[model samples]
Target chain A: MTKHKIRKLPLFTLIFFLLLFMAGVISGEPSRVLEQSRQICLSCIGIG
Target chain B: MELARKWVQIVIGFLTNGYWAFPFTRTIYQGPLKVVCSPGLNCYSCPASTTYCPIGAIQQLIAGIRFNLGLGQYYLGWYVLGCIGVVGGFLGRMVCGWACPFGFVQEIIHKIPGPKFKIPRILRYVKYIILSVMVILLPLLAVNEFDMGDPWFCKYVCPAGTLEAGLPMLVIQPDLRAAIGHLFFNKLAILIFFVVWSIMASRPFCRVACPLGAFYALFSRVRLVRLRLNREKCTDCGACHQVCPMGVKFNESPNDAECITCMACMERACKYGAISLEVGGLPLHSSPLRKTTKS
Candidate 1:
């Protein structure tokens, strides 16, 4: 492994996930999470 | 440094669960911050939780993947996935060590005077199985008549949910108490078991059962912010191993997957200045005070 190679891997992984995060925003996923979270998640609390 | 970590834990715990008015209102936070992914395991349904648990959010999204795909909606939980991946890749299990509200709770419980015990090595694999089976596979595969599935891990398994959401919610809402039956007792029993176990063992949940811990462990090798061991300085004295609450041997394997990057090795254990916390090949915190007191 070269010096640049060590840096390259993490840089690429960060870029990929950052892009994925941006894509998620474009897909309106946060709204869904928000909507579900706003509801008192009965199952999450183990009551359901 | 440990004091700084403790303050970070406390501040983050408060900031993440920052709806401090929950006790008076007896209501859950339904604000805009609910959309943000909590890096820690603070319960989404907790009365004061300003941010949502990534695990619960992901499970809920995954549980509806098939149903959404069927309707051409395409709910891949990309935001949650990206959020987790970025954090894991960057910090590994630092979140577990420093920010996790539940882990903090366990650490506090472990402070109780008792003979501490190491978790069995075989049990470490159980967290991976739980992550794959309960968090992903079950939620994605086990759909009902409506083509929707359950957040199996949070619903059935996570004691964090039981402690943070169940008991507190029950206390807040008296009418909801009537709905509790076998499930509540089952979960309560699980919570009690872990609470007692933690008193004698450090983070048994993180060691053996936390799916998020399992996920982050995968990134331990590649995490940018990580520990580096200067073997030349190490004496193989076993000081780091004895001091590790998570039982990682720093001299032998600095990047051990189970390592939470708690820096106990860097801060308190390595009297020889062998271990250092680094970010992208640059040392950020290193060179601990030499031990005058015995380990």
Candidate 2:
């Protein structure tokens, strides 16, 4: 309704997603996901 | 919510595990797509799965190290946690209600002819315990002689793994039969119990057992997408609660951890239009309470 509330929405969303993206980048999550994703998890199937 | 759940299941089905192909080839489709993560508790070992299970990855990360900092090569699985955090923080437990294939299965089962009843409120705490004990603490604490901790949740629990991966894997590779033992039977029994329980209960696993759902529940309050209630518009009617599969009393606590964000209370049950869906404080869907004329 108000300009303040309207401005807050996109700013908040942008900041939130930016923070999550930064966290992922800082933690090397993409590579880890890439590596882990490739192999079929043997233990998940009760093999271990 | 039901239609959305079905649509999500279909889309995810196509994404993670494509339509059936020739049996002469590998039963499980393995490709570059495996690098992605499915929002729900789909098993990675499932021949159909194109993405990794975050829960399985988290347990593996916890168990990969011996906790001896200098001696062991360690990976904390920051990526898995980050992916989970982003998804959970954005959508909360909506993933459980809509995107989870296993949850879809449970929903279908609950539709069968059976006497239905609500589970005890105390049982809702069980998922948090499972997340802490089976998923996190056990893997971090228990280690073998080689110092590799076991994925207790994956091995001992996780009916998703049993149904999607174990059963399918067994069918694909019959030699895995010899590997089947007490642990397998134990997991199978748990799956059977849950399957039957799901028939009688609306969403027993989502309410009581899923660690992934428990993890997402933590973000329900702060997630960007949220259910907003206008007290002024509410008549204190219990229609929303009656429609809620998770049995959440939204009037009491709109952000209750058990809420799956299914929007049933918002779109379907609330005749008063007290409830609305919002993203980042911006109202996306609003149903304003109608004014009653005085005779």
Candidate 3:
């Protein structure tokens, strides 16, 4: 991928995960929500 | 401009992963040290973690079941090996540059005004020694009643634990405060020392202390994401060296283990687009067939 594409990939992924994370938080399953949140945290860390 | 950059860094750092906050607290209510990546050399025992730290996990594994090598072994092996092979392979020390929450903490602290003292050249090896002794040798050699060794770094050092786990818990739980003893005091002192050091140095822990940083440094030369230099187009202006916080002379070796892939020099000094990230000596931007030769 081009540099612009590579950079945009992370941005898009971040937005997608953020939306999923918010949905998980609102879904009312605390354990699953927490797991999703942890995944988002890992994504933010960018190592996973 | 410098102050603006510092403020931007501080704000971004704080918003991204400040441990001393309520959102972090809410996240930790689910589990401690459960975050996939241990930002700094913080121990897993730090209450702020959402996942287990690899170092802490390895130590705990070694301490728990003397060479039985069952579940603990599998878990530790997977995490460490996966981190090295996958994360280290892909990003190299970019994790240190951008992602690590603890690194962000140190960056913020380093912004404070002070005469930063460089650790003596001889003392640079101290972290490797710490890793060999505290991380590897102790757990492998020593045995207690439960066939476990101590988490020496976590117990004795690791400021990340002090700031992220210890202080918060101590504030919240009065009994923990009463139980505080010499061990807590010692860790606190180490934390203070590093905190002070950070104000002067770019990343003292990553430079001289972090075993994980050491691990990543090993792969930096051949990692999938690495700095490339086009020698032909390059005037040896030395701007890259000047911009590097880690004191790397990028022209000598863009793949220097000390280079954290922070892109500061790449952004600032490469007037000719001479420096770029590459895999297998090919710039990531170029077509596979072109295989443009470096200057």
- Model 2: per-residue lDDT, tens digit, B1-295? 5586678877876676662661455556667776677899988778878788889888877887565343543356666776777788778898888788888889889999989989888999999999999999998888877777878899988998999888887887777788788888889999999999998989898899999999999887678778888887777777787988888988888879988778888877777878888887778886544555212
Q: In terms of TM-score, how similar is model 3 to the real structure?
A: 0.71
**Candidates 2 and 3, the one with greater DockQ:** 2
RMSD to true structure for each model, in Å = 2.7, 3.1, 9.5
**Which residue ranges in model 3 land beyond 4 Å of their true spot?**
A1-48, B1-28, B31-43, B65-76, B117-122, B285-295
With candidate 2 superimposed using the best TM-score fit, by how many Å does residue A30's alpha carbon deviate from the native?
4.2
- Judge the docking of candidate 2 as incorrect, acceptable, medium or high: acceptable
Off by over 4 Å in 1: A1-6, B289-295
Model 3: per-residue Cα lDDT over B1-295, one tens digit each = 3354455455544433434443445334344335344433443334344444556555544454464444333222333334344556666676677656677678778878889665554555777787778877786678776555665665666667677667766665545566677777777787788888889887887778876677666667546577777776667778787777676788887778878777777776656667776654447642122233444
Which ten residues in a row are the worst by lDDT in model 1 chain B? Answer: B286-295
lDDT of 1 by residue, B64-167 (tens): 98888898876798999899889987988988999899999999999999887888888999999999999999998999999999999988889999998899
The DockQ of each candidate is 0.60, 0.37, 0.04
- The TM-scores, one per candidate, come to 0.95, 0.89, 0.71
Alpha-carbon local distance difference test for all models: 0.87, 0.78, 0.58
Question: Candidate 1: what lDDT?
Answer: 0.87
User: What TM-score does chain B get in every candidate?
Assistant: 0.96, 0.93, 0.80
